[model samples]
Target: MDPLVLGGIVAISTILVLFSGVSVGLGLLIVSTGFLLVFDGLRSLELLPEILFGKLDNFALLSIPMFIIMGASIASTRAGADLYEALERWLTRVPGGLVISNLGACALFAAMSGSSPATCAAIGKMGIPEMRKRGYPDGVAAGSIAAGGTLGILIPPSVTMIVYGIATETSIGRLFLAGVFPGLLLVSLFMAWSLYSTWKYGDRALLASTTYTWKQKFEILPRVLPFLAIIVGVLYAMYGGIATPSETAAVGALLCLLIAMIIYKLWNPKDLWLVLRDSTKESVMILFIIAAAGVFSYMLSSLYITQSIAEWIATLDVNRWVLMGAVNVFLLIAGFFLPPVAVILMAAPILLPIITTAGFDPIWFAVILTINMEIGLISPPVGLNLYVINGIAPDISLKTILKGSLPFVACMVIAILLLCVFPGIATWLPDAVMGQAL
Candidate 1:
């Protein structure tokens, strides 16, 4: 069979299986196996074990589980609640203060966690209740949390960045450094939108402001200081050549465990079991997806599908910027239906060659791709972050969550545009730190 014809069959079958509620890992595995059977017969089955091992052999991939455990440890403790409460005390005087505080908390959590759904859950659990008590609009409150949660992937220590770096052979440390500024930029844009929306359309009846004494504010500092220390320690170790990204992740996870057990006094045996159990499940799920994507990507390469797509793209007469825009649009559309990791796994292999051939920096493009994926997290229908927020605050309908997330989605678009126009926004820090674009 022609490779293109086979490609279409594989794509359609995979999509149908996914929409039919099969897990992504299983769906990809089944589709790839079917293609292998059709194309190479029984002999292809022998390659499965080798393919899975090769895919999972990377040292950098070890970081995924450690980072996940680090986040889970924080989540299992009082740290998430304390972080939100502290930010709320500090930001309550600002317009749309509660929402701003929620965004702030999400940013902080994203810095530490590297997972969007985890960030959404940690902040939403605390912020939504407070917003309800303050009479804030459900849509805005839920939307702020949903949209802000996306920072989990754009910010440093992002699991998505790690996956992207591994998939593209880009530097994971540099990728981490590159995300810092864009993450801050998104945080600013989200907060600005919150302030503007509150001033322009928020219910004044629900916008009650609070005052905190100097002593009171200082008291909350202890609650967040340890987490800050972990962030600082991890980054410094990676940048100062004290540890690799994987090593830094291990250290960070260990620190989080100690903090939960010692400082927070929150780690009982059952709590410990829950954190380990949850982290193991999440880590295993991600790895399984990676393994399955490996098989699918290999099949695409073997069939020459990716190369044909790239060559076809290369022949297009459109300007590189136009191509970039189209890629962003495609990714945005894909994001609405796919998770960031899945998008990266499927799109990066095909698009990276086309993008690099167009003469764009791979590091800068990674940031852009990540931001686009970030928007998808809160996008309507299958956006994971939206579902996470809705699950947390079930009374807030999915419609309300989607409505609230729209503004933040706009904020993300603006951020992407800014990054495109001034690629330095994403590249400058990493360049300065690494002394070259990684």
Candidate 2:
């Protein structure tokens, strides 16, 4: 059978199964196994154990569970509430200040937690209700949290970055450094949009302003100081060449636990157990998907499907930029259906070769692709962040959350275009800080 035809059949069947509510790991496993059995005979089944073990044995992937535990630990504390209070008190005078503060809080939390759902759930629990009480529009309140949550994976310490780094054999440290500026840029863009939306569309009569005394401002510092220390410590250790990404994640997790137990005094045996349990569940789910993706990716490679597709793409008469645009479009559409990790796992094998062939830097393209995934978190149908917001604020319909996210989605699009036009936005910080691509 033609590889393309077989690839098409595999792709369509996988999508149908996934849409039918099959877990991503199982869906990928079933599709890949079926394809391998039919094409390569029963001997191909033997590769499953090797692929699963080899893929999960990496030291770098250790950071996913550590980072997840760190995030979950912090979420168990009052850190998120304190951070939200601090930002809200300082920013309330500005237009859409509350919403902007939500964005800020999300960014801060994203620095610590590299998962979008964690960021959304942590901040949304506090930000959404407060915004609603303050008479902010439901869509605006929900949208801000949902959109801001996407920052989790784009910021450093991102689990998706770990997966992408391992998948492409790129340096995880470089990917972390590359994300710093783009993450900040997206924060700025989201904040700008929030300000504009509130000023233009918000009901001024209901958008009450507040002032805080210097003493009050100083008092809020204690709530945020511990988190800041953890962020600085982790980044310093990683960038100062003191530790690898896994080491940094371990240190961060320990610090987060210490803060929760000692500083916040919010820790208990029960809560600690819950955090561990939740982290284990999430880590297992992600790692399982990765293991399945490994088998599927191997199957694609074994059949020369990815290479044939890349070669076919290379034969096109179109300019490289046009091809890049097409890739972006495909990713945008895929984001609506697939989660970021799945997208990176499935697409990177096929697209990275084509992208590098066009003389683009792989690190720069990783940043660009990360930004695209950021947008996907807020997009419809399978937008994880949107559902996260709805789960937090059940009264706000998914449609309203989706509506509110449209503006922020536009901000992400603008950010992506800017990154495309001047690749420096994503690369400069990594180059200046690391002195070379890691």
Candidate 3:
């Protein structure tokens, strides 16, 4: 088969496998292997071992498990819950206070967990009950938690940023710094939206007036200081050039382990075992996807499909913004049903070249892609955030979750436009920090 024909077949196979409810890792492997055999004969299949091993050999990739361990430790220890309560108390005087606090808590949790599901799960458990008890509407409560949970990808130390940086060979520390401003921008947007919504609909009454003495308020600080300290410590280490991103992750993991074991006393034998087990499982799944995607990508290149597509794209005499708009639309549609990781792996190889060819910065483009994927987490039908929130709030139907998410999804759309129009939102921090370093 010709390269273009092989690419076409692989693409179709991948879509079919996903639509058939097969696992993404297995689906990509099957499609890639099938293409290899059809195009290059059985001998090509022998490279699978080397391919898989090479993917795992990456030192940068080691950060995935370390981050997962830190996140799992925080989750199991209930530290996120404590931080949410602290934030709630601090922000409760404002309108839509619970929702605002929820977003704040999620942001803080995002810095710790570097994951959407864990952030959602941690905050949802505490936020939902508090909101419901305070008479907040079910839709609003669920929506806020869902929206806030998506923060895990936007904030610093984000697992998605790490993954993207690794895949593209971008500076991970720079990517982390690059995300800070945009992530905070999204958080601010969410807060503004939540306040407006609450004011329009009328907020629930404040919880019982229990005045905490200054001493009592100060007591809550001890619980949350670790979460904040880790963020500062890692960024400082990276900024000082004392540690690479991977090495920083190892240090972060060690600190988390000690905190769980000594400070929190949450790291019993069973808990440690569970964290290790879960981290290993999640890491394997991620590695499998990366390897399979790598193989499929190699197959596409061998087939010359990317070149043909690039040539066709080059022929179009359209404005750069129009071309970018089209790519965003493609990602948004794909996000409705596909995982962000899959979309990134498959689409980046194709769209990235077009973006560079159109004179856009890859650093900014990566941020744009990150925003698009974050939106995907909340989009309906197959939204991972929706399923996560639904799993936590079982009484709420998927319809309710989707309905609640629509407004925030709108907010995300607006956020994307803001980033597009103002690329500095993504680039400024990286430039400032890296400039100082130089």
In terms of lDDT, model 2 sits at 0.88
lDDT of 2 by residue, 25-88 (tens): 9998888888889889999899888997788888989899999999998888778888988998
Per-candidate TM vs. native?
0.96, 0.96, 0.95
lDDT, ranked from best to worst: 2, 1, 3
Candidate 3 stretches with Cα past 4 Å from truth are: 1-6, 207-211, 436-438
Worst 10-residue lDDT window, candidate 3: 204-213
Clashing pairs in 1: none
lDDT tens digits, residue span 1-438, model 3 = 555565666677789988998888788778877777777788888887787667667788878778888788888777888888887777777788888889999999998888898999999999987887777778888888898888898788877787777667678888898888888988998889888888877765454323456676678988789767987898899888898888888899888888878768864798789988988898787877787777767666666877777767888999989999999998888888887777777786777778889988778887888888888888877788889888988998878888887788888889889988898898888888786323
Model 1: how far residue 310 lies from native, Å: 0.9
Candidate 3: residue 112 Cα off by (Å) = 0.6
| Clashing pairs counted in every model | 0, 0, 1
Candidate 2: where are CA atoms >4 Å away? 202-207
- The model with the greater TM-score, 1 or 3, is 1
- Could you give candidate 1's per-residue lDDT for residues 323-422 as a string of tens digits? 9999999999888888888889877888899999999998999999999898888887689998898889998889888988888888888988899899
